[model samples]
Target: MKAAILDQAGKPLVIGEVDIAAPGPHEVLIRTAACGLCHSDLHFIDGAYPHAMPAIPGHEAAGVVISVGSEVRTVLPGDHVVTCLSAFCGHCEFCVTGRMALCLGGDTRRQKFGGARLTRGADKEVVNQMLNLSAFAEKMLVHEHACVSIDKDMPMDRAALLGCAVTTGAGAIFNACKLVPGETVAIIGCGGVGLAAINAARIAGAGQVIAVDPVPEKRELAKVLGATHVVDAMADDAAKQIIAISSGGVHHAIEAVGRQASADLAVAVLRRGGTATILGMMPLDCKVGLGAMDLLGGKKLQGAIMGMNHFPVDLPRLVDFYLRGLLDLDTLIAERITLDQINEGFDKMRAGTSARSVIIFDT
Candidate 1:
């Protein structure tokens, strides 16, 4: 099987052969159909996020189940599914509390670490799966918990983004922030994840959906996707613009850029008693600093992992929205590349031009 392996930081991926993995107990082996190139992946490649090198890094994906372990019953071979990072353990305290996204109990549903899920060079080295999916390869040995079956009719390429961008964006509103109708919302960074936040704000009945991005291309695209306003982060006083647009501050400000600056802006533009959801994956050891005095006014800052997604419930709803023509999955895909062209896709993402470049394996 062919895969793109990041063996070192600040390096191009090595496109080469790797041994295909078989399913372990409670796991599933999926034949890769499509995987979206996301900015988060680049963050790891650039060492913004620490990852064991020589790893197959991909998380957002959709594929057909090729094999399943004996204990796997949620899906079977030939079933189409979308993979998510929020693979849950039903017995975890967080899962029992109805916050499955926060499930910390290790996946009883699958094997852990280097269980021969991926290997390279005549099996001399084992490769790690990013977020346990590693859909960058020709196949994946993932916990069955990471995947949820969706309509096979959904273009696999488009369905792949639903695993991360769509779920992160919409679920933040419907799950994490629980945004109310007519609330003013500002989304920082109009990339794949941020754009989803804008579209979700619209679907949630937000009164004002402000799309903030440094790129004009993305700002324009955001309008088409459902943002009511677009603000340039590079512009002077961009935070002030958001505050002005929402008449002092937005009720919900989402930071999807994963930068301290954007995190501060998301906090700064929040109205009193407002919530700011950090939907992006920040670099390890970095913190979003906020003034204690400002926080005293009841403004809140919080982390949202995988949009606090409950895959079984949220994924099907998102798929239905896609089928209903409300969610703009197509609009989010700026380019469709072959699996071999994944490195170039990440380059485009780093350039801040493409929204999302999906690897169309089945195409």
Candidate 2:
């Protein structure tokens, strides 16, 4: 199989052929259909997040099941599925507590003592898989729990975004924030995930949705997706603008750009007793918080893992939303490229001019 391999941090991914192992008792084999380029992958490539080298980096993906292991009954050949990095162990304390997203998913992978799932076809050297799914390749072998069946009619390119950007954005609203109708929300950043957050806020019936970003194009795009107002993050009084627009702070604030400043703005524009959810993958050394006065006013700040999603249940519903024309997956996809053009796709992402670049496998 052809895959874009990341041999080291702060370097371009190299395209190469890799050998894949057949599924184990609890695994599934999927023929990759489409995978979306995401900022999370960029973090690893730019060396912001640390990971093992010689790995394939990608996770947001949708594909067709080619085969399943003996114990895998959730999906069968011909089933269309979307893969999530948040693979879970059903019996873990997190899973048993209704927080499946927090599962460490240790049981999902082949033991390090055992042979690896992927290897360099030439040298037979073991290649690490990123986030368990490694959707950058022509095919993926993952634990059954990492994927969920969706409607066949869903476009592979669009379904791919649901695996990460959409799920994380929408899940932040439905799962973490539990936003009620008529509430106000301010979202910082209007990229793929930020736009999805804007769209979901509208569907959740937020009375006022404020979209904040430095780019005018993204702000314009946000309005099209359902933002009631847009603020320029680079403005001298951006936080003040959010508070003024929402009539003295919003009910909830979401940070999607993964920056300390954006997270700070999310906290700055909150109303009394409101909550701020940080969805961006901030630098490991970065620390963000509020002062004593801010907390004393009942304001809260917290982190969310993969939008605190319950993938098995949420993914299907998200597919339904797209089918019903409620979710704007079509606008989220900025371009489509083949596996060989993977590096170019990442360049576009770094430029911040595109929403999402999807890799379409020629199946």
Candidate 3:
């Protein structure tokens, strides 16, 4: 199978062929159909977040089940699926408490060395699977819990992003932030994730959705998706513009760019009692600073993991929303490329030339 491998940090991904193992007792082998190149992948690629060395970086993907383990009954050999990396162990303390996203109970994968999922690559390497799904290649051996069944009719190209971008964006608003209707929101960064947040906020009935970014193209795109206002962060008094348009402040602010500055913007734009949700994964060493005096207004800041989503439940609903024409998945995909062209896709994404470039393995 053709897979993109990253053996070092701050380097371009090496696209090549890799052999994969079959499924285990609770795993499923999926024929990769489409995968989204996300900023999280960039984080791992740049070593902003340390991990096992040789790794196949992909977490947002949708595909068809080619085979299943003996114990897998939720999906069949030909079922269509969208996979997530927030695989839960079902019986964890967090799972029992409804915080299953924090479960880290998997069989402690065997490598201490970075990057080694394949043993035949000469040195018994330990190419780490970014997240658990590792859907970058033509095939992946994912735990059953990491994948969810979606309607076969869903466009695999766009459906691939639901596993991450859309889910994260919508999940932040509906689940983590628990936004109220007619509330105000400002989402910083107009990338795919940020765009998804803008769309979801609109669906949630936000009265004033403010999209902020340095790029005018993205701000325009954000408006079409549901943002009532757009702010060019490079322009003078950007945050003040947000405050002015929103009339004092917004009820909820979200940071979609994985940067300290935008997170601060989300915090600064809040109205009394407003909340802020940071959806982007900042570096492990980075921190957001807030004054003790800011809490007096009952304002809050929180983090959202995978949109605070449960694949088994939220994925199907997301698919339904797309199928019903309520969610705009088409606009999210900037272009489609074949599996062999993945490097180009990543390059385009890095240049910020597209909202999202998908690796379309099946079509």
Candidate 4:
């Protein structure tokens, strides 16, 4: 199978043939259909996040099951599925407690002492899989727990976003924030995730949905996605504008951009007893917090992983939402490119112009 291999940090991924092993026990092999290029993958590409070299980096994806291991029962060959990075071990404490997304997923992969799942076809050198899925390749071998069967009617390109951006954004609102009808929301970014949050907030009956971004086009797109209002983050008083629009402060503020300033703004525009959910993956050394007065005012700040998702359940429902026309996925896709155009897709993301660029595999 051909895959984009990252040999070094801050370098382009090399497209070459890779050897993918057959499914192990509890694993599933998928014929990759579509994979979304996400900012999280860019973090590893730019060396912001440390990862093993010669790894295939991509997680947000949807595909058709080619085969499954002897023990796999969640899906069968010919089933359509969306892959998630938050693979969970069913017996773990987190899974038992209904926090499957937090499961360490140690049992989902072969033990370090075991043989590699992927290797270079040329030299037989092992190639690390990114986020347990590595959907950038022509095929992916992942734990059955990492994928959820979805409707076959759903487009693979759109379903790919549900794996990450949609789940993370809508999950933040539905799970982390537990947003109720008539509550006000302020989203600190208008990328794929932020726009999804905006759409979810509207569907949840939020009284007001404020979208914030420096990009005019994104702000406009956010409005189309259901944001009742849009604020320019580059303005002199972006936070103040949010507070003013909400008549004091928003009930929930979501930080979708992994930046210190955006996270801080999410905290800044929260109402008393309001919650600020930081959905972005900030730097390890970065610290975002509220001042003493804000805490005294009962403002709460929290971080969400994969939108606190339970992919097995949430992903299927999200697919339904799209199928019902409740979720606007049509506008979310900015471009559809081949595997060879993967780097250009990331370039569009870095430029902050495209909502999402999906790689459509010819299977």
- The TM-score measured for candidate 2 stands at 0.99
* TM-score for candidate 3: 0.94
Cα lDDT computed for each candidate against the true fold? 0.86, 0.93, 0.83, 0.93
Which prediction has more favorable lDDT, 1 or 2?
2
Q: Between which residue pairs do clashes occur in model 2? A: none
TM-scores for candidates 1 onward, in order = 0.96, 0.99, 0.94, 0.99
The global Cα lDDT (0 to 1) of model 2 is 0.93
Error of 2 at 181 (Å): 0.3
Residues 166-212, candidate 2, lDDT per residue (tens digit)?
Answer: 99999999999999999999999998888999999999999999999
Which portions of model 3 miss their true places by more than 4 Å? 105-117, 122-124
Better of 2 and 3 by TM-score: 2
Give per-residue CA lDDT, model 4, range 1-363, as digits (tens): 999999998998889999998888899999999999999999999999999998999999999999999999899999999999999999989999999889999999876665789999667899999999998999999999999899999999999999999999999999999999999999999999999999999999999999999999999999999999999999989988999999999999999999999998999899999999999989979999889999899999998999999899999899899999999988989989999999888888889976999999997
C-alpha lDDT of residue 87 in model 2: 96
lDDT of 3: 0.83
